[model samples]
Target: MTPPMTPVCAKPRRRRLAALTALAAVFAVLATACTGGGGTAAQDVQDSYKTLPKESGKPTDGGTATVALTPGLSPNYIYPYPPASANGTVIARGLMWRSLYRPSGEGDQIADTALSLAEAPAYSSDRKTVTIKMKDYSWSNGRPVTADDVVFSLDLLKAALKESPANWSFYTPGQFPDGVTAKATTPDTLTLELDTAYNPSYLLSMLTLLYVMPSEEWNIARTGGPHLDHSDPENAKAIYTYLTKQSESQSTFADNPLWQVVNGPYRLKSFDPTTGSFSLAPNKEYSGPGDSRLDQVDFKSFTSAAAVLNQFKAGKLTVGTLDSSFITQIDALKKQGYHVYGAPAPARFDPLVLNFENTTNNFDKVIARPYVRQALQHLIDQGGYVKSRGVYNGAASPNYSTAGSGSPYPPEFGDQAPYPYDPAAAEKLLTDNGWKVVPDGSTTCERPGTGPGECGAGIPQGQTIDFTLSSANTPAYVGARDIAFASQAKKLGVEVTIETKSLNYLYTNYGNSFAPANKDKWAAQDYGPLYLAAGYPSSNTVFNTGGSFNLGGYRNAEVDKLIEASTFGADPTVLSTEVTSLSKDLPVLFFPTPHTLVVWKDTLSGPPSSFNALLSFLYTPELWYFREQDS
Candidate 1:
C-alpha cells in the first residue's frame, strides 16, 4: 500500500511505502567505464551489484550534493498523509518526519532497526495486543519524541479517515485505526489493543506507514494558539483540518514554523514552487544513524527524461536515474565519472490497470470473461518487450504475476508466463469463444449467449473488442510497450486506441475511487509500477475490494477471502496463495518489471548500501559524503 510510482513523472498519494524515485532489476551489467575512484568498473554489466566502485577515501567536511528528482515527480506536499488527488512526490516526508519503522533496502529484511524510530513490536500471545517502545529520538525543537506523539499521530490519522477515506489512501473502513485503541501508557511506551488479531508481519508493515509527528508542536488547531490534547477525537479532527490547510500553502513550506520542527535527518531550507525543486540542510538535532557530514542536499526536477540525461552527460547531475531507452549511454556515463547501477526493485510490479467499471464499448463486460482476459494477456509480448531496444533494453525481467520476480511469496507459476505471447493463441481463444476470425479487421462476437463457447452476459452480437489505453507520457518505454501491445491486438482484430497523458494528470484524474465520473473515460491506464513494502508485499489496499487505491473496481469473492487471509491470518504462506490466485484471476494486465538504472557521481562516496537504496527509489542522502580528495 506504499505510494504507487509512475514509471517517470508523478507519485500518487500516500499508501504504505514512500514515493518511488524511478523504475526494477535483472542484474545484467552493461559495459563499465573507468571511474573517479581510479578503478576499472566491472565489465560484464550482468552483475548488478559489482558495477559500482568500492567506497574509498576519508569522509570530508560540509559539501552540497545535487540529487535529480525523477522527471516530473517532485515534492508538492509536506504532510505525511496526502489526499487521493495529491499528485507529485511526497519525498519530503522521509526527509523531515521519520516513519515509526524504517523500510529496509534489502529484499530479505523488513525494517532497518538502526534507522527506525521504534523498537520491534512485542505482540501478546493472543496477538490482539501489541506494545511498541520509542527510541531515543528528539525533534528539531529540542523536545523528546514521546509515545504521546505516536498516539497523537494515530488520532490525527483516524480523524483524516473519518472525514473521508480518500484523505488517506491506505485506509479500509474497519481496519487498523478504525477498530484499534491506542494508548500512551508511559512516556516511551505505546500500546495497541486490536479488535481482531492480525498477522505480525502484516501489522508491522502497516506501522511502516505511521510517521511520528511532534505532538507538542502540532497538537493545536490554530497557528500561534494554545496546544490542545490531540487525544480528543474532535480536537484531533480540528488539528488535522488545520494542518492539511496549512500544507496546501506550498509557498510557505520552507518558512513555516510547523514544518521546521522536524525529527528526521534533514530539514527543508528552500522550496521552488515553479520548478518543484527544493534544498535541504542536515538537522543538527538528528539523533539517528550516520554522521550528517553533507552540509546540503539539493533536489533538482526536470520536465522530461531527455533533460535529465542531458544533465548527466554534461556532468551537471550528481545523482539521478537514466532512462532504459538510453541504455547505450551507460559506458559514456561511466566515463563521465558517474557510478551506474541497476536492479529490480523489490515488491514492485508494473501493470496496465483495467477499469472494470468502465462501460465504454462495453469493456467491463468484455474484460470480465476469464478467457477474454487471458486472450488479451497473450497479446502482451513480455519477453520481446524486455529484449526490445526501445523498450526495457535488456534491463528488465519478465514478470507474469503480482508477486514479482524473486518474491518471498511467489505464485505457483513462479516466473513462468501463464499466458505466453502468441497471436495465434490469442486468436484461437477468441475464436473458440464465438468471436469472428477476422485478421487485420474488426472482429465481432458471432455468438452472444451465457453458455459455453459464447460471449458472456451483457455482450451482444456484433460487439467489437475495442478500448482506449491512457498511457503515461514519461519514461518513453511506456509508450513503446503500449504501441507494441496495440499492434499485437490489431493483428488479433482488437482495436486499442492510444491516448497519451502526463503522469501528473494520470495520478490526479485517472483513479476511479477519486474520479468516478471519469471511469468511463478511460478503459485502461499504464502509468507504471506500484511499489509495496519491500519485505512484505501485501495487496491489501491495491487489490482488495473497496480498496482506496484500487483504481479499477475489480471484485472477486475468492480473491477478497484470500486477501483477508493474508491480512489477518498468521500463516505466512497465505500470501503466496493469495498472489497465486490474483495471478490466475488476471485482475490487471502484468507487464515486465523494468530495472531502474541508478546513476550517481563517483566522487560522492558512502557505504555501498546507501547507493543500493537508490535501486528501490529510496533516498538516504544523510549517509552520503564527498570523498576527501573531491571535497
Candidate 2:
C-alpha cells in the first residue's frame, strides 16, 4: 500500500462541511483536522492499525452496549463542574453535557484561538475587552447558548458552592484569567474583560473546560437563597464559593435535570452503580455538527482485575482497563479473537509527592535526597515491568520523564534527556549516603540521628517506610498499588505498605482538603498511572503551588520560579526550557501511563486513530459511526 498522506495543521477553522447523512461522509470534514502528520513515536505505536476482515457497509444507527463500572455514587447537580473524574459522572458528562469550548474549538467547533466563534471576535485594539459570537446551537431542552448561558455558567460555578457545600473546584488562576469578568452584552453576544493582557495561546487552550448551561436551571439550583436574577457581583461571589466548596463525589442532587442539561451529541439514559454499568441514549434534540456513531456508549465498570479479565473472557466486555496482573490475559484475549488496546495515557505522572509542609516525619527522607531520588528512577526496570506484566503485546513502557513524552509536553526532551535503567547508580548512591552493605552484600540505608551515641536512640536500621494510598475501595487498584510497592520498593531496600478507602472518604477526608483527624485518613500517598484524554495546557491545576488541586504537598521555590516564568514569559522555547527543567528535576517519580481502550462489535467506524484515556475522554465520540450489515 502507498504511504499514507501526512497531516498538516490547517487554518484555525477549516471550511465547515455541509450536513450529510452518510456516516463516513459526515466525518470527512472532521478528519480534515487530523492533518496527516504523525504524532510522537508512542502515538504512532498506539495508532497502528490493519485492515478489518470486511465492511458490513451498513449504516448502523441503533444498538445497546453493556458496560462494567462502579455504580451508586450520589450526583452533583453541577453536572460538568462536578467530578467527571469518576466514571459515574464521567458517563453523564460525555453523554448529556457539552462544553462552551472544546479542546479543538470554542466548544464543538475547530480549535483556533484567533478565529474562535463562527464570526471572528471583535476585540478592542487593546485586546482587553473581547466579544464572542454564539453558534446556532441549543441545549437538549431546546434552549439556545446565549451570552447569558456563558455568563450564568461562569457566575453559577462560583455560586453553586454557596447553595451546596459540595461543589467542583475547576476554576482558578490559569483556567480563568486573573481579574477577568464575563457578562452578556446581548442575547447572542458574550463579552469578557481582563485586568491584564492574558496570553492568547495559553488562555485559548485553558478555556476548553467552559461549559454553558441554561440560566434558569443553573440559577434555580445554585441560588437556593435568592430568586432568578442577572449575573452580577452581588450573586457571583456567593455562587462561586458554594460551587468551589461543594463535595461533588457525595452531592445529594447530582443527577437531577433541574441542573443537568444536554447540549451535546448524546443524553444520559440510566446507570446502575451496583452492577457497575452506565447506559447512554442518543439525544434527538442534538443539533451539533459532525457524525455520531452508535446509538450510545456504555461503560461497564469492574473493581477487580480478575473480574474485568473474566468479563473480557466472557466476551461481553468491549472496552477495559486492568492492572498489569492481567498481563497473562493478553494472549487469551487475542486467541479468543479480540483486539487488544495499548498506549501511554496523558496528564499522568505517578508522582512520588513529598510533603514539604510535613516538618517532622518523612518516609522518603533518604530518597528525597536530590541525587538519591534521581538515582532511584534510573534503577526502575521499565522493560522488565512490561515483560512481567504481559500488557498488550508486551506494549507497556515506564514513565522516566515528567513532561509527558508524546503528551502536551515536549517530545524532543524525552530523547534528549534519556535516563536508561541503571541499577548500579542506585547502589552507588546508597553506598555514598551512609548505607552499609550486609555481610552477604545486601545494601540498606540508615537514618541520620537515632543511634545511642547519636541522640541516644537506636538508628533507623533500614529505611523502613510506611506509605498509605487512600483511593476508593477497589480490588484492582489495590492490586496494582501492591504490585508496584513489592517490586520497586524491594529494589530500593524499602518496605512499602498499601492502604485503601472509599472515594467519598478518601476524596473528602484524606485528600488535600482540610487535614483529617485519624491516621486512617492518610499517612502517606502512593497513586499512579494518570489517564488524561484532554490535551495538556500549561495551566494544570494539580501543578500550581498553593492551588486547590495541590494535594500531594509538592513545593519548590526554584520550581515555582521556573513555572512562573513560563506562565508570564512569551515564546514556546522559554516555556519548553522551564517545563523541561521541571521534568528533569525530581518533582515527581513518574511511572508508566497506559491508554484508555474503546471497542465496538466490529460494526462501528471511528477516526483512523484511537485516543488514549485522558482527562478529557469525550473527544472522539463524534468521530465514531455505526454501519449495520443490512445497509
Candidate 3:
C-alpha cells in the first residue's frame, strides 16, 4: 500500500513566460551537443553538469514530485534520438534541456568534489585540433553559455551525420564531413581543426556527452523551420525530407518549438500525454548558483507491468519504472517503510537482423547455421529470465554479441554473459550443425529444406523451429517473447508467432523498415535489442545489409567482415573481440538484457547509477533530494 504522495502542475505565469521562450530551440541542438567530463560518480557534488546531484540523500525544500509517464510517448520529444532516449524521457529531458557535457561522477576526485562544470579540453599537436573552454554558465533562461554555444552545437552535429558526437567519441563527424574545421575562437574560446589523426579523447569526451546551444537561438534553427537555411547543405535532402514528414505527424511533437527547451535546472511545468503525467519547476530564471529545494516535480504514466504493480499494490506508482513483480513484496515494502528499489534492466547488446533476402524460416534455417546460431546460445534462460523478471540482483549483464569497447567482456557484460547458460552445449552445437536427434527430442533438418536457390519458403516438415514476434512490442516486450516460447523454448524444437502492433504503427511504420517492398507492411519481428553504436561508420547505418538503420535485412559475409572491423578499429580491444564473437552466433534470438526498472520514493536520493536510453534525465537530476525535508 505505498503510493500516495504526488504533486506538481501549476504553471501559468504566462506559461512560465512561454516556457522561457521554449528554451530557445534547445540551444538549437546546442552546437550539436556532444561533450564529456565530470557529471557524476562523485566529484564534490559537481554542482551543475546541467542538473542532478545537488541534494544527495537529503536537502528537501517544499514537497512535490509525481513522475511515472508513458502513453504514446512525449514530454515534447524528450532528447529526441540520443542522450539515452527514454527512461522517462531521460528524466524529462534531464530537467529540460542539458548538454554542455557532463559525466565524470563517482563524485569527481572526491575532496568534496562537485565543482568542475568546465575545464577538460585541450588538443592540437596534430592530433587534429580541439580547444573548448566555456562554463561561465547561465541559462535556465538567463542565457550566455557561449564557447559560441559550444561551437554552434558542434556545427549541427557535423551537419547531422551524427552517430555519436558527445564531443569526439573518437572523431568521425563522418570523417570531418567537409565541415567542422570549425572556429568561434573567442566568446569563451572554441577551436576543433581536424582533417585526421583522431581521438583527443573524442573532444575531451564531449563533456560527458555535449548538449549546448544558443548561438543566435541556434543558428536561427538552420532555417529548416519555415524554409531552408541551417547554413544550407542543399538543405540536407530537404531536412531529411521534412523530419521524415514530421516524424510521421500527429501534430508533430505538440507544435514543436523544438519540443520546449530550457537549458536545464528544471522548467517544463505541464504535460499530460493522456496521463503519463509531468510537471517540473525551479528556474525562477535559474542560472546555477544553488537554491532549489523542490518546488514541484510530478510525472505519472503507467500502462502495465501490471499497471506498475497495481500502482505498487493500489498506491499509484510511487515514481518511475518498476515491477519484477516487486521483488517478493520487498518484505512487505520493507515492513511498510517503502523504499523498495529494484534493478536488472540493462541489456541492449542489440542483435537480431536476418533478412536472408526476406525471410521464410524454420527460424530461417537455424539462423542460417551460425554454429546453429551457436547452438541457440546454450539454451538461454539467463538465470531463469532474471528470476522471472523482478530484477535488482547484480542488475543484469549477459550481453555477448561479439563484445566491443576494448572487448574480452571485462567489467561490463556481467551476470554470466556472452556464452555460458549451456544445455549440453546447445545439444552439442545442434548435433554439430547437421542436426538430427529425432527419437522424441525433435531435431531433423540435416540440411535440405527450401529448394529454388536455398532456404526461403513454405518451410516445414516438422522437427519444429518457426519464429516471429513483433506485434509492436512492450507489453513487457510481448510478455518476454511469450515466456521465451513457453518456458525455455519447448525442449529446443522452438515455435513462436505473436505479431501484435500499434506502438504508433511499430515505431513509425514497421520500426525503420529493413527491406520489405511491402510484405504486408511488417510486424513479424521476433526479438529486439540493439545499440551497436560507440561511434560511426555507424555500421553503415547499422550493418548495411540495406541501411536505413537496418532493422532486419541481415546478410552476412562473415558478419560483414566483423561489422566492418568493429567500425574503424586500430584495436578497440580488437573491437571488443568482434562484439563477443557476434553474440555467440545467434544473430538474433539471444535475448535476456532488458533492465531499465528504476523505482524511487525512499524520500528521494541520487547517484547510484544506470542509464543508457542515451541519457538526459538531466543526466543526473543533480543526484536527487528530499529526505523528509532534509532530516
Model 2: per-residue Cα lDDT at residue 322? 45
Tens digits of per-residue lDDT for model 2 on 1-631?
Answer: 0000000001111112311122133123222211222321112233332222233455656655444442112233334655323222334553455566554411122243321222345566666777788777777787776778777877766554444322444433443534668868888888889776444544454454566666755554253555456466465654544443442423333354543466766666655533425556666666665456566767665534567667778887654454443544555666775555544444444444434343233443543456556655665455444433222223455565544535445534665434456666765655565565342234454534533222112225654333443433332322243344334545565444444443333344433422323333454454333322233335234445654444554556666766555444444345455556666666555545443343333544454343232122334455455655552
What's the distance in Å from true for residue 49, model 1? 7.2
- The clash number for model 1 is 14
TM-score of 1: 0.93
Q: Is candidate 1 or candidate 2 better by TM-score?
A: 1
The Cα local distance difference test for each model comes to: 0.81, 0.47, 0.43
Error of 3 at 513 (Å): 23
What are the per-residue Cα lDDT tens digits for candidate 3 across 585-622?
44455554444444555666544442222121213443
User: What's the lDDT for residue 589 in model 1?
Assistant: 93
Measured by TM-score, the strongest candidate is: 1
